[model samples]
Target: MEEMPLKTAEELEAECLRLLHANMTTREIQRVGIVRTHADGSGPNWTYNQLYPEPTPIGKHDAHGIIASVAGKWALVA
Candidate 1:
Protein backbone atom coordinates (compact mmCIF):
# COMPACT_ATOMS: atom_id res chain seq x y z
CA MET A 1 0.00 0.00 0.00
CA GLU A 2 1.01 3.62 -0.54
CA GLU A 3 2.21 5.58 2.44
CA MET A 4 -0.33 7.55 4.46
CA PRO A 5 -0.23 11.35 4.42
CA LEU A 6 0.72 12.90 7.70
CA LYS A 7 -0.84 16.14 8.97
CA THR A 8 0.42 17.19 12.41
CA ALA A 9 4.09 16.76 13.22
CA GLU A 10 3.16 14.73 16.28
CA GLU A 11 1.68 12.06 14.07
CA LEU A 12 4.87 12.03 12.03
CA GLU A 13 7.02 11.68 15.10
CA ALA A 14 4.93 8.79 16.36
CA GLU A 15 5.33 6.99 13.05
CA CYS A 16 9.04 7.74 12.94
CA LEU A 17 9.41 6.37 16.42
CA ARG A 18 7.70 3.23 15.28
CA LEU A 19 10.02 2.87 12.29
CA LEU A 20 13.08 3.69 14.34
CA HIS A 21 12.16 0.83 16.61
CA ALA A 22 12.38 -1.30 13.48
CA ASN A 23 15.66 0.13 12.28
CA MET A 24 17.04 -3.31 11.52
CA THR A 25 14.47 -3.63 8.76
CA THR A 26 14.46 -0.03 7.55
CA ARG A 27 15.03 0.67 3.85
CA GLU A 28 15.69 3.70 1.61
CA ILE A 29 12.44 3.49 -0.38
CA GLN A 30 10.54 3.16 2.89
CA ARG A 31 12.41 6.10 4.37
CA VAL A 32 11.58 8.43 1.50
CA GLY A 33 7.96 7.34 1.53
CA ILE A 34 7.66 8.03 5.27
CA VAL A 35 9.31 11.44 5.00
CA ARG A 36 7.23 12.39 2.01
CA THR A 37 4.02 11.43 3.73
CA HIS A 38 5.11 13.18 6.93
CA ALA A 39 5.83 16.44 5.13
CA ASP A 40 2.94 15.99 2.71
CA GLY A 41 5.33 16.28 -0.25
CA SER A 42 6.66 19.62 1.00
CA GLY A 43 10.29 18.43 0.53
CA PRO A 44 11.43 20.31 3.61
CA ASN A 45 15.15 20.34 4.49
CA TRP A 46 14.39 19.35 8.06
CA THR A 47 15.11 15.70 9.14
CA TYR A 48 14.33 12.92 11.60
CA ASN A 49 17.62 12.19 13.37
CA GLN A 50 16.27 10.83 16.64
CA LEU A 51 14.89 7.68 15.05
CA TYR A 52 17.96 6.22 13.39
CA PRO A 53 20.87 6.68 15.74
CA GLU A 54 23.32 4.99 13.35
CA PRO A 55 21.88 5.12 9.88
CA THR A 56 24.17 4.43 6.96
CA PRO A 57 25.46 7.41 4.96
CA ILE A 58 22.85 8.33 2.41
CA GLY A 59 22.01 11.81 1.27
CA LYS A 60 21.19 14.63 3.70
CA HIS A 61 19.85 12.27 6.36
CA ASP A 62 18.88 8.77 7.49
CA ALA A 63 15.34 7.51 7.99
CA HIS A 64 15.26 8.90 11.54
CA GLY A 65 16.67 12.24 10.48
CA ILE A 66 14.02 12.62 7.84
CA ILE A 67 11.30 12.13 10.42
CA ALA A 68 12.95 14.12 13.24
CA SER A 69 13.87 17.13 11.14
CA VAL A 70 10.23 17.97 10.48
CA ALA A 71 8.43 16.16 13.24
CA GLY A 72 10.82 17.45 15.87
CA LYS A 73 10.02 20.96 14.81
CA TRP A 74 6.28 20.67 15.52
CA ALA A 75 5.70 17.32 17.20
CA LEU A 76 3.59 17.60 20.37
CA VAL A 77 5.44 16.34 23.43
CA ALA A 78 3.83 14.22 26.12
Candidate 2:
Protein backbone atom coordinates (compact mmCIF):
# COMPACT_ATOMS: atom_id res chain seq x y z
CA MET A 1 0.00 0.00 0.00
CA GLU A 2 1.08 3.55 -0.63
CA GLU A 3 1.78 5.81 2.33
CA MET A 4 -0.01 9.12 2.78
CA PRO A 5 1.97 12.33 2.93
CA LEU A 6 2.02 14.22 6.22
CA LYS A 7 1.86 17.98 6.69
CA THR A 8 3.04 20.17 9.56
CA ALA A 9 0.57 21.96 11.77
CA GLU A 10 1.92 25.32 10.71
CA GLU A 11 1.51 24.45 7.04
CA LEU A 12 -2.06 23.33 7.63
CA GLU A 13 -2.81 26.54 9.52
CA ALA A 14 -1.44 28.61 6.68
CA GLU A 15 -3.49 26.80 4.08
CA CYS A 16 -6.61 27.28 6.19
CA LEU A 17 -6.00 31.00 6.46
CA ARG A 18 -5.56 31.27 2.70
CA LEU A 19 -8.82 29.42 2.12
CA LEU A 20 -10.71 31.86 4.35
CA HIS A 21 -9.19 34.83 2.56
CA ALA A 22 -10.35 33.32 -0.73
CA ASN A 23 -14.01 34.00 0.27
CA MET A 24 -14.91 30.76 2.01
CA THR A 25 -17.65 31.31 4.58
CA THR A 26 -18.02 29.83 8.07
CA ARG A 27 -21.14 27.90 7.09
CA GLU A 28 -19.30 26.48 4.10
CA ILE A 29 -16.45 25.35 6.29
CA GLN A 30 -18.79 23.87 8.88
CA ARG A 31 -20.39 21.72 6.22
CA VAL A 32 -17.31 19.50 5.99
CA GLY A 33 -18.14 16.37 7.99
CA ILE A 34 -16.69 12.86 8.31
CA VAL A 35 -18.40 9.56 7.77
CA ARG A 36 -17.84 6.36 9.74
CA THR A 37 -19.00 2.80 9.19
CA HIS A 38 -19.46 0.06 11.76
CA ALA A 39 -17.02 -2.84 11.76
CA ASP A 40 -19.67 -5.39 12.68
CA GLY A 41 -22.11 -3.91 10.15
CA SER A 42 -24.88 -3.83 12.74
CA GLY A 43 -24.82 -0.17 13.71
CA PRO A 44 -26.61 2.59 11.87
CA ASN A 45 -24.66 4.86 9.52
CA TRP A 46 -24.57 8.54 10.34
CA THR A 47 -24.13 11.60 8.07
CA TYR A 48 -24.03 15.41 8.15
CA ASN A 49 -26.32 17.50 5.97
CA GLN A 50 -25.54 21.18 5.56
CA LEU A 51 -26.59 21.83 1.95
CA TYR A 52 -29.60 19.53 2.22
CA PRO A 53 -32.10 17.90 4.57
CA GLU A 54 -32.57 14.15 4.76
CA PRO A 55 -32.17 11.40 7.36
CA THR A 56 -30.10 8.93 5.31
CA PRO A 57 -28.95 11.51 2.79
CA ILE A 58 -26.31 14.10 3.60
CA GLY A 59 -25.06 17.28 1.95
CA LYS A 60 -21.80 17.78 0.08
CA HIS A 61 -19.22 20.51 -0.28
CA ASP A 62 -17.77 21.85 -3.51
CA ALA A 63 -14.35 22.11 -1.92
CA HIS A 64 -14.41 20.06 1.26
CA GLY A 65 -10.71 19.23 1.55
CA ILE A 66 -9.66 22.81 1.00
CA ILE A 67 -12.12 23.98 3.66
CA ALA A 68 -11.35 21.27 6.23
CA SER A 69 -7.69 22.27 6.38
CA VAL A 70 -8.74 25.00 8.83
CA ALA A 71 -9.82 22.26 11.25
CA GLY A 72 -13.07 23.92 12.34
CA LYS A 73 -11.58 27.32 13.11
CA TRP A 74 -14.72 29.23 12.14
CA ALA A 75 -14.18 31.70 14.97
CA LEU A 76 -11.07 33.06 13.28
CA VAL A 77 -13.13 34.82 10.63
CA ALA A 78 -14.25 38.40 11.33
Candidate 3:
Protein backbone atom coordinates (compact mmCIF):
# COMPACT_ATOMS: atom_id res chain seq x y z
CA MET A 1 0.00 0.00 0.00
CA GLU A 2 1.20 3.46 -0.84
CA GLU A 3 1.42 6.15 1.83
CA MET A 4 -1.10 8.96 1.50
CA PRO A 5 -0.04 12.53 1.15
CA LEU A 6 0.01 14.54 4.35
CA LYS A 7 -2.87 16.92 4.77
CA THR A 8 -2.14 20.62 4.92
CA ALA A 9 -2.95 22.39 8.16
CA GLU A 10 -6.07 23.93 6.66
CA GLU A 11 -7.37 20.57 5.49
CA LEU A 12 -6.68 19.06 8.87
CA GLU A 13 -8.52 21.84 10.68
CA ALA A 14 -11.54 21.59 8.42
CA GLU A 15 -11.75 17.84 8.89
CA CYS A 16 -11.45 18.21 12.64
CA LEU A 17 -14.25 20.76 12.74
CA ARG A 18 -16.46 18.59 10.56
CA LEU A 19 -16.00 15.52 12.71
CA LEU A 20 -16.57 17.45 15.93
CA HIS A 21 -19.82 18.95 14.74
CA ALA A 22 -21.02 15.70 13.27
CA ASN A 23 -20.44 13.75 16.47
CA MET A 24 -22.07 16.34 18.70
CA THR A 25 -25.09 16.82 16.49
CA THR A 26 -25.63 13.10 16.15
CA ARG A 27 -25.36 12.56 19.92
CA GLU A 28 -22.90 9.73 19.46
CA ILE A 29 -21.26 11.02 22.62
CA GLN A 30 -23.05 12.72 25.45
CA ARG A 31 -21.80 15.74 27.32
CA VAL A 32 -21.90 15.07 31.01
CA GLY A 33 -21.42 17.03 34.19
CA ILE A 34 -20.38 14.71 36.97
CA VAL A 35 -21.72 14.86 40.53
CA ARG A 36 -20.48 12.92 43.48
CA THR A 37 -23.05 10.89 45.37
CA HIS A 38 -22.94 9.74 48.97
CA ALA A 39 -22.28 6.27 50.34
CA ASP A 40 -25.96 5.87 51.25
CA GLY A 41 -26.68 4.80 47.63
CA SER A 42 -27.88 8.29 46.79
CA GLY A 43 -25.05 10.73 47.55
CA PRO A 44 -21.82 9.34 46.15
CA ASN A 45 -22.49 8.56 42.50
CA TRP A 46 -21.77 10.40 39.30
CA THR A 47 -24.57 12.14 37.43
CA TYR A 48 -25.08 13.64 34.00
CA ASN A 49 -26.51 17.04 34.84
CA GLN A 50 -25.21 19.24 32.02
CA LEU A 51 -26.46 18.74 28.53
CA TYR A 52 -25.15 19.92 25.18
CA PRO A 53 -24.47 23.60 24.43
CA GLU A 54 -23.85 24.15 28.13
CA PRO A 55 -20.80 26.16 29.10
CA THR A 56 -18.44 23.38 30.11
CA PRO A 57 -15.18 24.13 31.84
CA ILE A 58 -13.28 22.50 28.95
CA GLY A 59 -15.61 22.72 26.01
CA LYS A 60 -15.69 22.74 22.22
CA HIS A 61 -14.81 26.42 22.19
CA ASP A 62 -11.29 25.36 22.97
CA ALA A 63 -11.23 23.08 19.93
CA HIS A 64 -12.42 25.96 17.76
CA GLY A 65 -9.47 27.97 18.92
CA ILE A 66 -7.15 25.14 18.04
CA ILE A 67 -8.69 24.83 14.60
CA ALA A 68 -8.31 28.53 14.02
CA SER A 69 -4.73 28.43 15.10
CA VAL A 70 -4.03 25.63 12.67
CA ALA A 71 -5.74 27.51 9.85
CA GLY A 72 -3.79 30.68 10.61
CA LYS A 73 -6.94 32.64 11.40
CA TRP A 74 -7.08 32.66 15.16
CA ALA A 75 -8.60 36.16 15.19
CA LEU A 76 -11.70 34.82 13.50
CA VAL A 77 -12.03 32.16 16.17
CA ALA A 78 -11.65 34.53 19.11
Candidate 4:
Protein backbone atom coordinates (compact mmCIF):
# COMPACT_ATOMS: atom_id res chain seq x y z
CA MET A 1 0.00 0.00 0.00
CA GLU A 2 1.19 3.51 -0.78
CA GLU A 3 1.21 6.22 1.89
CA MET A 4 0.25 9.84 1.14
CA PRO A 5 2.37 12.76 2.21
CA LEU A 6 1.26 14.79 5.21
CA LYS A 7 0.33 18.45 4.79
CA THR A 8 2.54 21.23 6.17
CA ALA A 9 1.34 23.51 8.97
CA GLU A 10 0.44 26.33 6.60
CA GLU A 11 -1.42 23.94 4.31
CA LEU A 12 -3.28 22.52 7.31
CA GLU A 13 -4.36 25.95 8.44
CA ALA A 14 -5.59 26.92 4.97
CA GLU A 15 -7.41 23.62 4.58
CA CYS A 16 -9.03 24.01 8.00
CA LEU A 17 -10.29 27.49 7.20
CA ARG A 18 -11.62 26.31 3.83
CA LEU A 19 -13.47 23.45 5.52
CA LEU A 20 -14.88 25.79 8.17
CA HIS A 21 -16.21 28.19 5.56
CA ALA A 22 -17.77 25.33 3.60
CA ASN A 23 -19.43 23.99 6.75
CA MET A 24 -20.77 27.44 7.62
CA THR A 25 -22.20 27.91 4.17
CA THR A 26 -23.85 24.51 4.36
CA ARG A 27 -25.27 25.20 7.82
CA GLU A 28 -26.65 28.55 6.76
CA ILE A 29 -28.35 26.89 3.81
CA GLN A 30 -29.92 24.22 6.00
CA ARG A 31 -31.08 26.74 8.61
CA VAL A 32 -32.64 28.93 5.98
CA GLY A 33 -34.42 25.77 4.69
CA ILE A 34 -34.44 24.36 1.15
CA VAL A 35 -37.12 26.67 -0.24
CA ARG A 36 -35.19 29.86 0.47
CA THR A 37 -31.73 28.44 -0.23
CA HIS A 38 -30.94 30.92 -2.97
CA ALA A 39 -33.28 33.77 -2.03
CA ASP A 40 -30.43 36.25 -1.91
CA GLY A 41 -28.10 36.57 -4.85
CA SER A 42 -25.39 36.55 -2.22
CA GLY A 43 -25.03 33.86 0.41
CA PRO A 44 -25.21 35.22 3.98
CA ASN A 45 -22.52 37.79 3.41
CA TRP A 46 -20.16 38.66 6.26
CA THR A 47 -18.73 41.62 4.40
CA TYR A 48 -20.30 44.66 2.77
CA ASN A 49 -19.68 45.41 -0.95
CA GLN A 50 -17.90 48.73 -1.13
CA LEU A 51 -14.58 47.34 -2.31
CA TYR A 52 -15.18 48.90 -5.68
CA PRO A 53 -16.92 52.22 -5.33
CA GLU A 54 -19.63 53.43 -7.68
CA PRO A 55 -18.11 55.46 -10.45
CA THR A 56 -18.45 59.17 -9.94
CA PRO A 57 -18.25 61.44 -12.95
CA ILE A 58 -15.83 64.33 -12.70
CA GLY A 59 -17.21 67.82 -13.24
CA LYS A 60 -17.01 68.81 -16.90
CA HIS A 61 -14.99 71.84 -15.76
CA ASP A 62 -12.39 69.40 -14.49
CA ALA A 63 -12.48 67.31 -17.62
CA HIS A 64 -12.76 68.32 -21.27
CA GLY A 65 -14.73 71.40 -20.28
CA ILE A 66 -16.07 74.52 -21.94
CA ILE A 67 -16.25 78.08 -20.58
CA ALA A 68 -19.39 79.71 -19.16
CA SER A 69 -20.27 83.38 -19.60
CA VAL A 70 -21.39 85.91 -16.92
CA ALA A 71 -24.89 85.54 -18.36
CA GLY A 72 -24.93 81.90 -17.20
CA LYS A 73 -24.57 80.63 -20.73
CA TRP A 74 -22.04 77.91 -21.64
CA ALA A 75 -20.08 77.84 -24.90
CA LEU A 76 -17.26 75.80 -26.37
CA VAL A 77 -14.76 78.59 -25.64
CA ALA A 78 -12.40 76.62 -23.48
- lDDT digits (tens) for residues 17-66 of candidate 4: 33323542221111110111222222221111111122124422221111
Q: Rank the candidates by lDDT, best first.
A: 1, 3, 2, 4
**C-alpha lDDT of all candidate models, in order:** 0.43, 0.34, 0.36, 0.23
Screening candidate 3 with a backbone cut-off below 3 angstroms (N, C-alpha, C), the clashing residue pairs are 37-43, 37-44, 37-45, 38-43, 38-44
Q: Give a tens-digit lDDT track for model 1, residues 6-73.
A: 35445655566565545554443333333232334433323443333344555224554545554544
Q: What's the TM-score of every candidate structure?
A: 0.32, 0.32, 0.29, 0.27
Q: By TM-score, is 1 or 4 better?
A: 1
Off by over 4 Å in 2: 24-66, 69-78
Off by over 4 Å in 1: 1-4, 24-46, 49-78
Top lDDT hit: 1
| Tens digits of per-residue lDDT for model 2, 1-78 | 332243333444455445644653332342223332222222232222232221121212434444454443322221
Instruction: Please give the range of 10 consecutive residues that has the lowest summed lDDT in model 2.
Output: 51-60
